[model samples]
Target: MTWLITGGAGYIGAHVVRAMTGAGERTVVYDDLSTGDAGRVPREVPLVVGSVLDGGRLARAIAAHQVTGVVHLAAKKQVGESVGRPLHYYHENVEGLRVLLEAVTAAPVTAFVFSSSAAVYGMPDVDVVTEETPCRPLSPYGETKLAGEWLVRAAGRAAGLATASLRYFNVAGAATPALADTGVSNLVPMVFHRLTEGTAPRVFGDDYPTADGTCVRDYIHVVDLAEAHVTVARALRSTPGLDLTLNVGRGEGVSVREMIDRINAVTGYDHPPTIAPRRPGDPARVVASADRIATELGWRAAHDVQDMITSAWEGWVRLHPAAARA
Candidate 1:
C-alpha cells in the first residue's frame, strides 16, 4: 500500500517512516516542518510540504501520491503549552485532524492509523491503564487526542474506513543517532540535559504513594513504538472497516527516581536527582496493560529500560559531544 505519513519529518514520525519503508511499504512524507526536520526524511521517500489544515493541499497530495493509507502524527503535544493556549491546541490538533479526515474520507484512502496518546487517560486512577479506562483528560493536549480518536473512529464507521488509534505510552530511544529526538521535553532527555550541564536532575515530588515516593510511568522505545505503528497500519490495510483502540507499551512501570538512577548508570554519572514538590495533576502510576494489543497483534516490546537508556545516550552524545567526556 502507498502510505502518506503526515509529520514524517519529526522524531517519532521519521522512525515510523523508516520502519514502514524498511518493511517494504511505499511511503510519502507530508510535513509542515514546524518542529520536523526535512533532513530526517529518507531520500527515497517523497516529502510533501503542506499542512493538515489545508484541505486542498491534502487532497492534491493524496491524489498525486495515490496514497491508499495514512498515518497522521502532526499535532501540538506539549501539555503545559496546551494548558496556556487551549485554543491553539484545539485548532492545530482537533481541527487539523478533522480537515485531514475529510480529505481522507473523500479520497480513496481506505485505512488510517492515528497517533493517539496515553495523555487521554490524564492522571488515571489505576495501576495499569487499559483501553477501556474512563478518559478524563486534565489538559487540553489530552483532550485534543481523545477528540481526535473520536473523530477518527466516527469517520471510519461512517465512511467504511478501517482505522486504528494506538494510544502510545512514554516514547524514548531512537533507531539511530541521526534519528534521535532533539527536543528536551521528555524525561530521558531532560535528565541528560541536566547531567550534561553538571547539575542535579530534578525529581518532581518524591512523596507519592510508591516504593520510591515518585511518579511511576511506562516508557516504550521509539523504535518499538514505530514498529507498533507499522503493525497497526498493516492490520488496518488488511481488515476492512476494522476499528481498534489499543495501548502500545511494555506493561511495566518505572519510578521517576529509578529512571534517574538508571540514567546516571547508563551515562556513567553518579549525580543523584534532587527532590522537588510534586507537580499538580501528576499521577502516581500510569502503566499500560498491553494485553489487548498483544492478544490482537502478537506484538510485544523487545527493548527493556536499559536498552532504552543505552541507545538514547548514544544519540545524546551524538548531539552533545561534551556529554560523553563530562
Candidate 2:
C-alpha cells in the first residue's frame, strides 16, 4: 500500500512520514514548503513540492507515486491568524481539501486519513471529550477541519473508500532535536521563546474556574501521535468502508500553571510567569477521552508532560544556544 503524505515535511507531518516508512510502508511526501521544511523529508522518500490547491499537481503526485492511500496534513492552523484572515484560511484549508478530494476520488486510492484538531470541539463542556462530542469550532481554522471531516467522510462513503479523521490535542516534543517543531505557535515553544529571552512567560489568564484558575489542555507526544497514524493507516487498509473519527490525546488535562511549572523545572529558567487577560478563543478545559483510539488501534500515549518538556527544551537550545545558559 503506497501512501502519499501531504505536508510531510512539517513538524507533525515529518514524524508521520518517518513512522510510516519505519514500519516498512511505501511512502511519498507532498508538501508546498509554505510552512514546511524540505530538509525534513528523508532522502529515501520522494518529495513533491506543490500546493494541494493545485489539482493537477496533486493528481500527478498521486499517479507518479502510484499512491493507494493519502494522509492530508497540510492546512493553516493558527487560531489568531485564522481570525484575522478567515478567507485565506478557508481558501487554504477548505478549498485546498476540496481539490484534494476531487483528485483522490478520481484515482484508485481507497484509504484516507485527515489531520484534524481538538479545536473542532471548541470549549468542550465535558470532562473527557469523546468521538461523539458535538463540534462548535470557534476559529476559522477549526471550522475548516470540521468541514473537512464531513467532506472526507461523505466522499469516502460515495467512493467506497476507508477514511479516518484523527483530532489531535496539544502536540509537543520531537524524535530528534533537528526535527523539533520550530514554530512558536504552540504553548511549549511559546514558553521556550519567552524564557530564552530572559522574560517571564505570559500565562494568558488565571481567572478560569479550574484549579489554579488557568486554562487546561490535553497534551500529546509527537512520537506517539505519529505511531497512531501508522496504526490507523493499517486499519484502513484492512477494513473496507471504515469511517473512523478518533481523538489523539493523553486524556489528562494539564493546567496552564502546571505546564509552566514543569517547563521551569525542565529548562532551569525558573522565571515567574505574568498573568494576562484570557484570549478570545481560549478554551477553559478540553481533555480527550482517548478510549476510541485505544479500542480501535490498541494505541495509548507512552510519553508524558515531562517527556514533552525535556525533548522540546533540547530542541530549543539547539536553535538558540543562549537558552541553555538561562
Candidate 3:
C-alpha cells in the first residue's frame, strides 16, 4: 500500500519517511519546504513540493501517487511564536488540516495518522497525563492541535476513515545520519547551538514544584517517535477498529536544569548554564503515561535522556564542527 507523508522532509516527518522506506513500503512525500529540507528526503522517494492549503495540488498529488493512507505532519509548531501570532497558527494549522481533509474525502483514503502534540494537556495538576486527560491548552499552538484532533475525529466518523492522532511530547535527537540545517526547535539543539558559540546556554525557570524546581518535560527520541508512527500505520492496516488518540512519551519528566547538566556532562563543557526567568505561559511539569500505545500497539520509547542528548549532539557537531570545541 502506498502512503502519503505530508511534511515528510521535516524533522520528525523525515524520520518517519525513512522508517516507512526501511520497512519496504511504498511512500511519497508532500512538503511545502517552509521549514523542511528537500535533501532530507531520500532520492528514491517521490517528492511533491506543494502546500496542504492548496486543495488542487493536494488532490493531484493524492491521485497521482494513488496514496491509500496519509500521515499528516505539516504544521506551524512553536509555543512562543504561536502566542505572538495566534491568527497565523490558526490559519496554518487549522486551515491546512481542513484543506487536507477535503482532499482525503475527495480521494476516499482509507486510513489517516495525525501528528499531534501533548500541548493539548497544558499544565495538568497531576504530573502524568493519560489519553483521557482534559485538554486545556495554554497557547495557540496547543489550541490548534486540539482543534485538529477534533476535526480528524469528526471527519473520520463521517467518512468511515480510520484515524489515529499521536499526541507526542518533546521529540529530540536525530534519527538518520543526515542532519537538519534549519528550523531546529527542540531544547537540545538550541542548547547545542549556544554551547558551540562559546556562550552558556540559558535555562528558563529554576523555581517550579518539581524536584529541581525547574520546569520538567518528557522528551522522546525522534527515532522512537517515528517508529510509533509506523506501528500506528500497521495497526490501521491490521485492525480497522483501532481509531483513537494515544500519547507517545517515556512516562518521565526531566527538568530544564537536569537537561543542561546532562548536556554539560556529555559535551564536557566547564561553563554553567545561564538561568533565566520563565517565559510566560510556561508549564510547570508535563509527562505522559503512554500505557495505551504500549498495550495496544506494542510500542515503547527505546532511547533515554543520554541517547537523546548524545545523538542530538553528534548531529549538531556534524553540521557545525566548530561548535563542538571548547
Candidate 4:
C-alpha cells in the first residue's frame, strides 16, 4: 500500500506527504527540488531527488520502493508564466506526465491520483462549476492540466489502473507556517507579498458582474486540499479501475476585494488596494460545486476565508520577518 508522491517537497505536495504519512500510509516523496525545499519533507519519509521527465528514474524509484500507487503532483503551474513559455510548460507538464505514465503502467502500480486544477475550466461562465463542465483551458498551464487529466484517464483505462483527478480551486493557508506556500503565483500569496513590501495590493479589476464587481473564486485551505488527496488515494485503492474526477473546494465564492479586506484585517495592515486592468483569461466567477467529492468520498472543507488569510499571513511573516504586524 505504499504511495509515491511526485513533487512531494513543494508546498502543496509536502502537505500531501505529511497528511498521508501522518495517517499511517507508507509514502515516498519524489521531487527534483526545482522549487521544493527538501527540508519540508519529513526525515521519516524517503525523499527521492529527480525530475518527472526522467522515465528511467521513475521506473527505478517505482521498483525500488515497490510503489503500488502514485499521486502525481509534479508540474509547472503558473498561468502568466505558462502563457509566456508554452513550450516549456508542455515539455515539463504534458510530456513529463506522458513519460511518468509510461513508466507507471509498465510497473506494478494499480492506483493513481492526479493533482488537476480549476484552471482546466478556463473562464468558466458557470456560477458553480462541476466535474461535468466543459473544459476549455485558457492558459497553457491550464491546458497542460486538462491534457494531463486526459492522459491519466486513458492510461489508467488501458493499464487497468484506478485513477482520480482532483481539480483544485484556489488553494491557500497551511496547517503550519513552515508548510505554507512560498510561491506568489496564486492570489493569496501575491497579496501577501505586496503587503509585506509595504505596497498596496493591486486588485486586477473591479468591473466584473459579481456582487463586489471583482473576480470571485473558491479558495480552499491547503490542508483540506491535501486531505482530499489522501481520501482520493484510498478510494482509488478500494474501488478497482475507478476514474474519479472531482472538484476539491469549499463551493463558496469569495471576491478578490473581499479577500484583500480580509488580508488587511488579518495581517494588521490597513492599506487599501488599488484597482488595475483585468488580466486576460481572468474569469468573473469560478466556484466549485464540491458535491461529488462529498458524496463520493465524504469529505468537506473545514476552513473558512479568515482561516486561509490568517494562517497564510503567519507563514508569510515567518519567511519575511520584515512584514511583522504593526
TM-score of each: 0.97, 0.98, 0.97, 0.98
Model 3 / residue 149 / CA error / Å: 0.3
**lDDT (0-100) at residue 227 of candidate 2?**
99
After the best TM-score superposition of candidate 3, give how far the Cα of residue 289 lies from its true spot, in angstroms.
Answer: 0.3
Give per-residue CA lDDT, model 2, range 173-292, as digits (tens). Answer: 999998899999899999999998889999988998898899999999999999999999999999988999999999999998899899999988789899988776778899999998
Model 1: what TM-score? 0.97
Local accuracy of candidate 3 as per-residue lDDT tens digits, 1-326: 79999999899999999999998778999999999999998999999999999999999999998998999999999898899999999999999999999999888588899999999998899879999989999999999999999999999888888899999998888764475423446788888778777898887878888897888999999999989999999888776645879999999988888898899899877668888988766789999999999998899999999988888887877777776756
Where is model 4 more than 4 Å wrong at Cα? none
Residue-level lDDT for 68 in candidate 4: 98
The residue pairs in collision within model 3 are 208-213
- Provide the lowest-lDDT 10-residue window in model 2: 317-326
lDDT of each: 0.93, 0.93, 0.89, 0.92
Measured on C-alpha atoms, candidate 1 has an lDDT of: 0.93
Q: Which stretches of candidate 1 lie over 4 Å from their true place?
A: none
Candidate 2 versus truth, CA RMSD in Å, comes to 1.0
